[model samples]
Target: MFSGAQISLYPMTDDFVGVILGALGALDPYRDKLRIETDDISTLLVGPPEVLFPAMRDLFVAAAASGKHCVLSAAISRGCPGEPDDPICRSDAVGGPVGPLSLRKDAAIAAVREADVTGQPVAVQFSLYVMGTGDHMDEIYGCIDFLKQSGVFDRSKHFCSRLRGDAGAVFSTLNEAFCRFGPGAGHVTLDVTVSANSPTAI
Candidate 1:
């Protein structure tokens, strides 16, 4: 299996880079066959599927808790190691009546297993498209009523979400939320997972 990760460093602090490098070193033994290549605000991690997955999670959690604004992106290719599928984990958008997308239970457990074992925060991937339900004018917003009524909202720049929570809760809620759209309305396919995460520029 092959896995890759990308992270975005926030707050743009001088101390941030050194801290993450140190933490990742501490996690070396726990991380399965991990490697690093870094730039100014991002890092790249590539490694085995199982080990890379969790290592990425642990690294980001450590970096974030260390008092830095950090977000991550990652992908894991299971079995084939060379070929991987696109599975989105979390998505935020404005088109449909719905406000945001979250996970169900099935996807959550699998992603968490990778996070728990490797000690890295999870990575969520999402792509928006119609799901074959709802009104045509509804367009992107499948649940137009729900979007206006639901109090769920965030202030992030990307209409997508990357979260870390209880192994089960995070993935399950994301999956469930996106699929909630119906009857001709499109939905985003979420493939959230954990890997040996590094910053994109680093």
Candidate 2:
């Protein structure tokens, strides 16, 4: 059972390099808890959901705080059979007995409600993929139901859903979607893009 995200940040400014470099400092608190590696394309963060979402939120907030439009794109995944299981990725959020879908949705909503509030506001669009399952659509539909009531949900779009709200709630909702919809130990992935301070937003 492994979990992680490959994330890239793009700041819309002449000083993109400065914004990106300064924003990375936000991950300092999570350094010990996650295995982080940055390359030209993106940064990989391998860790539990508890630490993962917050670390991302902080980093995004830091970049957005620069008053520059910013976008964060991420490919988040868990229980990937191809990847070697790392102890650092261990978390209660994965590999557990999955109960009723109704119950899981309830629990996920509760978790999102309790997320720490960040002042930054963001909009995200994402699609969840529950791989290697015959009843994957059932899981995806269930996740959709959860999102409609997630408070952060903005609307549905082609091939994905849109969410808008405080960074805390938006990220928490994403975390829940990743953890609760699929088989606890099965391969699941999320294609996500988040934006803040976008000049073209309307």
Candidate 3:
């Protein structure tokens, strides 16, 4: 039932420090909604999808808006092993109500759309690992099937699929996967590594 994300931002520009700092600032407003911690390598955010996805969208949009070649890499996980099981990690943690999927999708889409307006399309690649289940492979394949039919997947990659399209659609697809594979009776952990950048940059 735990959900969290570890993210690292790399701005491919001379002003990398400034760009990264600005991107981090985008999460400031949501401090109350997330448990955020930052060190030299990356920032960790623990919270529900309602706040987490929007925060991610805003942070990426803010960073991409700099028009510098940048890459945002994230590890989003739920029910991880050997981790403290605290309220922040729990899906039922006391916070604002979770928003509808459509609303979350809209937020991500808007951010990506804003970036796309600058004439650059954002590209994202991610691998989802569903663990702790007896039929893990079956669940994984089921999820993959769902993604392929979901209309947001790139279809060119497998096992580790490459997602390419409007940012919002990509994020929405990701969010759905995360939710579906989260902690359950037979399922224990869902780990995802996501890397995003501008199409021309990478």
lDDT for every model? Answer: 0.40, 0.94, 0.63
lDDT of 1 by residue, 52-168 (tens): 434544555566555454554433222232334322211222123543333222333343344323233434433333433455345334332322222222112254433443423
Off by over 4 Å in 1: 11-14, 30-32, 73-202
Tell how far residue 173 is off in model 1, in angstroms.
Answer: 9.1
Candidate that scores best on TM-score: 2
Superposed model 2: Cα runs more than 4 Å off: none
Off by over 4 Å in 3: 90-120, 182-202
Candidate 3 lDDT over residue span 132-156, tens digit each: 6565675566566666655556654
Model 2, span 42-98: residue lDDT tens:
999999877888898999999999999999999999988899999998898879987
Each prediction's TM-score against the native? 0.41, 0.98, 0.75
- Candidate number that wins on TM-score, 2 or 3: 2
Error of 3 at 74 (Å): 1.1
RMSD of each: 10.6, 0.7, 5.9
Candidate 2 has its poorest 10 consecutive residues by lDDT at: 90-99
**TM-score of candidate 3 to 2 decimals:** 0.75
